[model samples]
Target: MKRSIKRLVAFVFLFLALNNTTAQSIPDSLAQKIDKLFSQWNNPNTPGCAIGVVRNDSLIYAKGYGMANLEYGIPITPETIFHMASVSKQFTAYSIVLLARQGKLRLDDDIHQYLPWFPDLKEKITIRHLLNHTSGIRDQWQLLAIAGTRLDDVITQDHIVKILSKQQALNFKPGEKYSYSNSGFTMLAEIVKAVTGQSLRRFTDSAIFKPLGMKQTHFHDDYTEIEKNRAYSYQRKNLFTFSNSVLSYSNAGATSLFTNINDLSKWVMNFYTPVAGTAADIDQLVQKGKLNNGVELNYALGISSDTYKGYKQYSHSGGDAGFRTYLTVLPELKMGFMVFSNLAEVNTYEKTYQLVDLFIKDTSAKVNADIRMDSSRAIIKDEGRAKNFTGDFISEDGAQFSFVLRNRKLYWERYGNSDLLYPGLKDSFTVARSPEIKFVFSTTPGKSVLVNQYWPDNKRLLVKYATDSIQTDNQLQMYAGLYYCPELDCKYTIVAKDHELILTSNKYNDSKLKLVGKDHLFTDYWWMRHLKTISGNNKKIIGFEVNDGRIMHLRFNKIQ
Candidate 1:
């Protein structure tokens, strides 16, 4: 009987040890939370995303959450290929870095050294300026849009080059300010072709992808090239509908890259472990851009350097047609994640960050501001005080804002959206849901101004309109005519309609012009404001000139 009791005791100890081991080896619950986050896309009938997570040079998790080929009933897998729109910029930037390292080209060299056909704008735009978007060249896509080309239309590199070649001016001087321009990148790709005998696709395929063993990756320049396992892009109307990337696949630098999560994960891992490029080349690829004034911008060569919840992040997001993609890497944490989706509506950035939260430790202690202005804290007593802030305000950068009083409340309106302001102190108010934005109104006559206090050191003052009234419709008719801008090869027609002046352009939608001064007008379009009409020696209408932040004093000749 004693022997049997000892045997039972031994069995009980084994059971306890087994339970401890099972508890130690249990899978992390974070994975389940991530799976739940993608629940909407975890179906066989909808377009979804392919995600991959890498840590210390290994892919810890890779999965797909929706239909890759809806018609064929093929479920998305990690290997499913997706078009990464602007995310392709990084690879293009890397190609430039590689070429620079090979001594084939110099970053500071003038672009005219290679593309002599380019107009001499009398500006010193270097190759580095193009890579970092400081060249001041108008965006290629925007220029095309201004020239009556739509995004859905098929546009090739030659078509963009033709438009760029005819341009005689830039938005700003090189390196004077930072404006995101796709034209710079397209030019960079052309430089790559000019320096090397082959195309960007062939050069990168042999130089980068082949060396890294990424077989499914390439800068797809031909839309007709049949790619296996390619996931079709889609958008939801009443139901999911296939959206073709109608853009010509001939562009290589600014966009046009076809890759899969499996291959992209390899690219992310390269940031941690060097293989395709040398350490210096990789460093240059991610270095932040500096302006002429010595101010550094968050944008690097192709990626954006930022912070998320206390960790430093190098990331990029892309959207084109029905494809949306995001890729982020936390170099300090040695962790990276990529989400590529064929559905345009997917918030890939939010989803990727949510997934990162599960895997990374959160050490952020940042708190929201505790200051709140409620009815009990109200200090303003005069109802007329609200009127002091009501009017149009113009900033130095040509950005316009409107303050309106409605329903006994003050609202800050921009781009047709209103944000109710909370009264803080006398002559000062704070924007709701945005504690960082504060407005102070100075009611001095002729010198009245509205000061916008955004960041701690960033303050912008907008001069208040002192004029009592605008010009009458009879006076507005004098400016009505057809005006042509030779630089853009586009025309603007001003017509008097409904007691106001309506400006119509074949390239852009019609906009109503509001008379702010004797001969000056403001449009709802913020970028194109501060317009002044000119007259000939005979007192007949000659044309007008637009003085904006980017395009300063751009003139148009009156043809009718």
Candidate 2:
């Protein structure tokens, strides 16, 4: 009896211990929540996504859902590589700083010192301005399109400099306001080339990629070099099919980074502990810059640092035609998360934040003020004012468009492409195909209306609206003149042709636009819109405006 009792006690103790061990090793319920969030992308409209979460230098969860290459039935995984797009900016900025530390270059040096052929703006713009996006240089991609350059053509540093040199003015005064310009970063890439005598790909490989042991990461210059374990980029088609698209590598600094989540996790670690450079050098790279009055610029060299839900956060996002990505680091909590998608229309940022919030147990975590949207006002029944609101509203880029009312219905267009319209819950409309866009229409005075487009997924683009007036004059004779903005050193000559207004800019072909209202013109493409007669003096037109709020006033000498 004694022997049996001792054996029974031993068996009971062993059972209890095993039960406790199993419970401890099991993943938390939060893991299930994360799985559910990712599963949402498995639908036809949503794109496939890869996600990774790190807690205290350890990977807590890593998984991919749906298909990376739907045509081939390939699945997305944490190791699948995707184009990082603008997220590559931080890496580019770091490379510049590394070169600066080696005495090869100075951040404050004038760009012309490196690229001697660069345009001579009236004001001297320095490398510091480029790094901080205060260079006032016009966006190169837009300029290229205007200059009749093909989007797929290889653009070199010299090409960029040639274009800038010919530019008579800037988009704004240097160091006065902040505008996100890809041209600035492209210039920095040139400076890197001038100093190191090495292409950006080689320099970064030697200085950053190899040092960090990021063997899977690369600049993606040539697609022919078969990349092992690279995720094929995909675009959603009709909720079932996904099409593949190729992105060029000529835009290495501004975009064209091919990487996976595992590599990005290591990159995030460098933010906490410097691996390639000294602590001081790292601080200089990540430290936020400020204006003369000590106000924070809200952007670091390449990364953005801000407060979210009372916690200091650093994050960046990237998007191209076929891929989207996001990386967020919460340094104080020693946690970071990254998400990548092979298909477009994925909410990588939101999904990333949800995972981070679950891990941190911060239910109240909020995004920065600049990214969040204000709550929509309650909708009211149409009070006989619907007729006044019926008209066409256009974008400055001549690509984005919206119609106020048609058969008592509202609609919007993306880049002038016709897709079925989706009904918004309130006084709004959206693309039945795109889940990210929302259009809100409101009435104004004098048969005019206001239309606002809300892109909740795109943090970089604020909600844009246009006020339309029907009293606009369609006659082009009165609007013909040479309009100039000294601040930008740019000129526009308006000419009438075939009942349409043609705007001709330096190095750009004539843009044929139809006058829809007194001062408004709509183009064949939806991204471009024009507002003329912004300034009037006794029935004389003075200036015109672009969609981004840039105004070009006519010179007194040129106006008739």
Q: What is the C-alpha RMSD of each candidate to the true structure, in Å?
A: 10.5, 12.9
The C-alpha local distance difference test score for the whole of candidate 1 amounts to 0.77
Clashes of 1: 0
Error of 2 at 171 (Å): 1.1
lDDT of 1 by residue, 371-473 (tens): 4546443334566877777888766445678888876677788898887777777688888757578888775665565666553323466766556775677
lDDT of residue 71 for candidate 2: 49
**Whole-model lDDT per candidate:** 0.77, 0.65
**TM-score for each of the candidates:** 0.78, 0.68
Best by lDDT: 1
